[model samples]
Each structure stands twice: as structure tokens, then as C-alpha cells.
Target: MTLSPAVDAWAEEEPGAATDRSGWPGGIPSRVVRPRAVIEVQQLLAEAYRTRTPVIPRGAGSGLAAGAVGVEGAILLDLSALDRILELDADEQLARVEPGVITADLDAAASAHGLMYAPDPGSVGISTIGGNIATNAGGLRGAKYGVTRDHVLALDVVLADGSLVRVGRDTIKGVTGYDLVSLFTGSEGTLGVVVGATVRLIPRPARTATAAAYFADIATAARAVTAITRSGVRPAVLEILDGRTLAAIDDLEGTALRERGDALVVIQTDGYGAEEELEVLTSAIAALATDVQTATDAAASDALLFARRRALPALEALGRVLIEDIAVPRKRLAEAVDGISDIAQEEGVDIFVFGHAGDGNLHPIIVTERGAADDPVPDAAASAAERIFALALELGGTITAEHGVGRLKKEWALRELGPEVHALQWRLKEAFDSRGILNPGSSL
Candidate 1:
């Protein structure tokens, strides 16, 4: 491959850059280029566009959806070198950053100014801000703080044809034209490469109260969640884990969580009225839970939150895991949990349930016997996933809550989106990249 002198950047042909955290086996790309400047990105995109070559934009590559998996004969654009917090205006309560800025780094920086970046996905520590925007990523705080899209104020994107266009305003509120900021936010790099972003931040909470409740089963824990939500106390974080998940965590961490109960509900209330909110939440949860434990200090609070964070890793220790994300109406959360349990039993597969129960976004992970990393996912697990997706739709929810439909879920996404909407989305992509480049074969 040849490049113009104006676009001075090193290209790596190594196979390591061709893969991401997604188990999808991506073909070796022609080259992986890390551009240090916006002009270099534009130049590279322009050259790729002229040659009609596929260009895949990538950040920290922590995505679960294989959205950044490299394709054969493609140019993998690694944007990690562009990590720079260009501006942090405490008065304006916003920060402007390059695409490679780590999400946690930004949050820490904001915290110094008594503010916080609220879109904390599970991969926040390692995931980049640009990647978060790509999926509109959500975390435990989503029920209260919203997702990446809620914080993003503007984006500087480089179109497939190499045009640099800035969409959205820096101010808090604006509706001058079409909401392109939102349109491109969750487009999953299919529309364009996000070179930079301006994201809003809010004042950090003064205090937080954390608590954990144990229930006889997941369904009961889910009911407690519903009760808490209806009790008029909005928690900063609300998460749930099933019996299998709790046992796995206990085995891995040497904790006796399973002995206490078959299910766990972790809640955190924040801001000035955090204690008062906790009083209400504890009262509601205690009515349904067999046991309740409240944190007495910051360390204890983190210890309680650790269980939710370790749920996936704990399950991974048991065997190969196929994690699924889905969301249903909050009122029907218990129904969804029961339906998942039924699916697992019918399929004769081990499906561990956990997720942001407050918002109905559940992660029903299917575990199979240990196998090679490259081995295909079991057919039974795939069938169970389809059934779960159907269940979510049947309950007036979505096939996906936060994770974008990368190559892994594109077919199911098309079914959920319907043919007419899918056609319009394709046309929209054409309007942005007529050559059909830019993260081809992924995210619609």
C-alpha cells in the first residue's frame, strides 16, 4: 500500500491489530494506520475513498459486538494516538476531546472539577469515549444518568468521502436543524469516523448510599426492583444477579453470597438526599428480600458493587460464555426473568442472568462446556438467544438495549427494524458513503 506524504503516519501489517475483544475471527487487514491528526485521518479516508477500499474505524477495541473487527483488504484506522482532552471548561460544564480519550480518564478529570461524566458502560475503564458514542453505551447508572448519547453535545466526524463536518452545538440545548448529532451517535461507525467530540458533564453527587438485598430467586429480586422504582426513590445505580451468577462469583471470589440467597440486588442512591432515598429503597426491598446489607463506608460500598462487576468474569471461569443483552418494559421485568429461566430449562442450557434490572436491560449469558476460543458458538446457545430476543420483543421491549448490532446481531437487528426501515437506513448510509465503504458489513 502507498500513502501520500501529507498523511504522515506509520502503518502496521501485523495480524494482532486485525482483531478485537469480540470472538469473531476477522481476516488480516491490508494495513492498520494510527493517525495522529484530523488532517491525516481526512487524507487517509480520501485516499481510501478514491480507491474504493474499506476503512474500519476503531478505538480501544473493547466492544463486545465485533463492530471494529477488521475485514480482508481493508484499512483499519486505529485512532488511539489521538487521545487528547482539548478543552475542559468547568464553567460551561463540558469537555472537548479527541476520539481516543479513555472514558474513565475523562470521568476522573471531570471529578477534579466537582463534575462527572455519567455514561459509564461496563467497559468504562478501558473503553474509549468515541467507542461509547458508537454504541450509545449504557451502564448501571443508565436508569438515572442516561447513556452516552445523553452526554454528547457535538461531534466532529470525517465522512467516507473525506469531508470534515461538525454536527451539533456546544451549548446545552439546541434544535436548529435535524438532530444529526443523535443520528450519528449510535450509527456504529457506519455513517462516518468520529474524530472528536464535545460532551456535557454535570455536578458530582455529594454523597452516595449503597445497599444489597438477597432474595430467594431472581424473580423475587426483580419484584423488589419494581417496588423500589415505584416507591418514588430513584437510585443512582440498580443491578441484579441470579442464583447461578451468584454461585459462580462465590466460587471465584470465595464469597458465600449463594448461601445467603439465590439472587442479589445492589442499589446505590446518590446526591443530597441519598440517605433519605436509601431509607425508602431499603424499606421497599426489605419487604421482599430475605436479607439486606447496607454499606457503612466507601470501601464496603465498592465491595458490594464488585459482585455486579465480576458477574461476567466469574461466569467465564466456568466455561465458554455467550453473553446476550436485551431490554423489556420495567413493569414486566419479573416476567422476562421468568421467561429466561424457562428458556434455559427448555433448551437444557445454563443461562446466568444479570443486568440493570431497574431499566429492564438484562444480560442472559449462555454457558457451554469449555471449548477452543475459535470454536463456533453452540447451536443450542444460538437458538436460546433467538428465543430470548423473541421474548423481549413480545414483552414490548427491544432486541438490544445498549450494544449496537455489529456483524454478530445484524440479521436479528434487520428483523427487529423491519424491511422498510432497513431500506431507509441503507439509503441513509449511501447518502453518507456512496462508495459503500466505512465499517462495511457491520452495524447496518
Candidate 2:
């Protein structure tokens, strides 16, 4: 089980090996291989497959899910070294990128060509494109722009047998075969390693506007979100935050959020219809708000949107947070939120709620004591998370709107997928990786 000096040098369990942002200090790997080229990946996988070694493909490791945590005696594929933008076809509005390219970096590059990558996950700043595709991550703007899967056109995958195979079509409208692009996109590396990808880009919005609608109650704020959605006003982004989250945000920036309201809705309108759409949504929201204020200028708009984006970070200040990505019908968001709040009380956990209300995706971040992550008060946090998932399911919502079913949520995934479909998923896993060498303990 000896690797070449260069291979070992490139990916040894040395001092340079970085721990991911996930903060899950789990198992130590037999080897951490950073492939410089596709051939290197092919060679590594070929040997691993022959030896029946476990391999886990990893990117920037911004994932909170334990999906990429290396198994003992496994080979951890560090894809960050493969970062590259192979091609950007502005005319076709497509970008060919290596797996390790940072998500936000691709968006920035696309913006330069008058195009923009659609998915804007919270960790876009450092998360990899391959990781996003692996999770099909949703963003604040997912209500309108959709998730990472919607933009993925094709993929270059390295299979367990060390074969470099291409799945999916480069064109936008291709249904010639099974949709492997979509299939593999959210497979979370259990099936294969995504070496490269062709991603679709949309035209950048011509203009953008934002408004903050404040409500005395969370139900009213959610009702405003539903009304805005039903009013034919397609806001680029619509977010709602509970009073606790709003108060924390004010403390973070000295904003008057706590003084203004207990709950707030932040809406952003974009494209050529930016102003017109905002006008309609704002009017609708005002009818139900204790006070509604549209950002009078672009600076103010940016501030409002920035505040909404800061929800997760502000919550982190209180304690270690287990952020939940659950989504229900937009009409049922307030009910779901209320039930989530009840769970916090029942479980004796501090829960701050916020998310894209337009699409019904909510983040119920469970906060616990800082150092408690190792072993303190696990019951309360665990119970809160479980109840949140159960409540989401009862409300006809998914346990995870965007986050993949990693090691953390595998149990819930089993409950959600059921036996028949779960068995089919296992067949798919077997079809691509019969030996179970690729991402063992991931996906199915």
C-alpha cells in the first residue's frame, strides 16, 4: 500500500493538510491525495479499486454535513488543487470549470461577461463548485433562480473503476438519455468523483432593489411573504427573520431592528422589472406590516439585503449552532415556524429561525453552549433538531431543502426515502460503485 513519493508529497497526512470548516474532527485517513491532473485521479482510483480501498472526494470542505469526513484507512481526495476555469463561452452562457473552483469566484467571473451564476449559497465565498453540485445547494434567491442543479449542464466524472466517463449533455435542452447530470449532481460523491463540470449562466440583472418590511409578529411577516408571492410579484430574494434573530442582528451592527419590530421581511427585486416588482410587493407587504420601509437608495438596499444575509453569522455569536435547512409550502411557513418555536420550548433549546420565505425554505439554527460541542447538553440540541425534522415532515416539508443527506442526517433520509425508493438508490450506488470504494457511507 505504498504510493509514489510525489503522490505522497502532494497528499500526505502532513502538517499542510487542512481541516475543513465543518469543524468535525473525526477520523484520520490512510492517505490524503491531491491530484494535479485527471490522469493522476484515474491512477489513484484504479489502484484503490484494485485494493478495495475507501475513497472520499472532498473540495473546500465548507460542508457542515459529515459527508466528507474521512473514514479510517480511507483515501481522502483533496480536489482543491484542481481549481481551474477551463473555458467560459459568453455567447452560449456556459462555463467549463474544474471541481475545486470556488463558487463565488465563478460567479464573479461570470459577472464580468454580463452573466451570473444563479446559486448563491451562504458559503459561496469559499465553497467549491463541485461541492455545490454535490449538495445541489439552495440560496436566498432560490425561489426565483433555482439551485445548483438547474445550472449544471454536464460533468466529467472519475468512477471507482478508474474510468474517466462523461455524463449529461453540454446543451440546455437535451433529453436523449437518463438525466445523469441531475442524477450525479446531488449524489454527494457516493457514485463518482466530479472532476469537471459545464455550468449554465444567466444574464445579469439590469437593476436591483430591496425593501425591509417590519412586522410585530412572525405570522404577519410570513403572511406578507405569501401575499407577495401570490400577487404576481417575483422578488429576486425574499427572507424572513424572527424577533430573536432580528435582535441579534441589531446587536451585531447597532441597527434599529429590535426597536422597529419583532419580525421582519427583507425583499429584493431584480432584472428589468426591478422597480415595478418591488412596488407591487412593497404595497402588498405594507398592508400587513406595522411598518414597511423600502430602501430609498442602492446603498440602503444593499444594507437591507446584507442584514438578511447576516442571519446565520449573527446567530453563531450566541453559541455553537446546528443550522437546519427545512422547507415547506410557502403558505405553511408560518405554521412551520410556530411549530419550530414550540420545539425550542419543549426541548429547552435556543432556536433562531430565518430563511427564504418565498420558497418556504427555513433555517432553524439550534444554538448551544460554545464548548458544549464536544459533549455538553447534547440532549436538548439533538431533541430540538429531531422535532424540527418531524414537524417539517408533518407540514409536508422536506427535512433538508438543500443540504445533502450526509452522515449527520442519514437516519432522517432513511425515514424520508422509505424502503422501495431507498432500495432503488442502493441499486444506483451499486451500479456505479459495486465494490463500495467510492465515498463509502455516503448517500445510500
Provide the TM-score for each candidate, comma-separated. 0.96, 0.95
| lDDT comparing candidate 1 with the true structure | 0.89
User: What tens digits encode model 1's per-residue C-alpha lDDT throughout 87-175?
Assistant: 99999999999989999999999999999999878888999999999888999899799888999999999999899999998999999
Top TM-score: which candidate number? 1
Model 1 ranges with Cα > 4 A deviation: 1-13
Q: After superposition, how far is residue 294 of candidate 2 from its true place, in Å?
A: 1.9
Candidate 2 residues 292-380, lDDT tens each?
77764678888888778788888888778887888999999889988988898888889999988878999898888888333543788
Clashes of each: 0, 0
Worst 10 residues of 1 by lDDT: 4-13
Residue pairs with backbone atoms closer than 3 Å in model 1 (clashes):
none
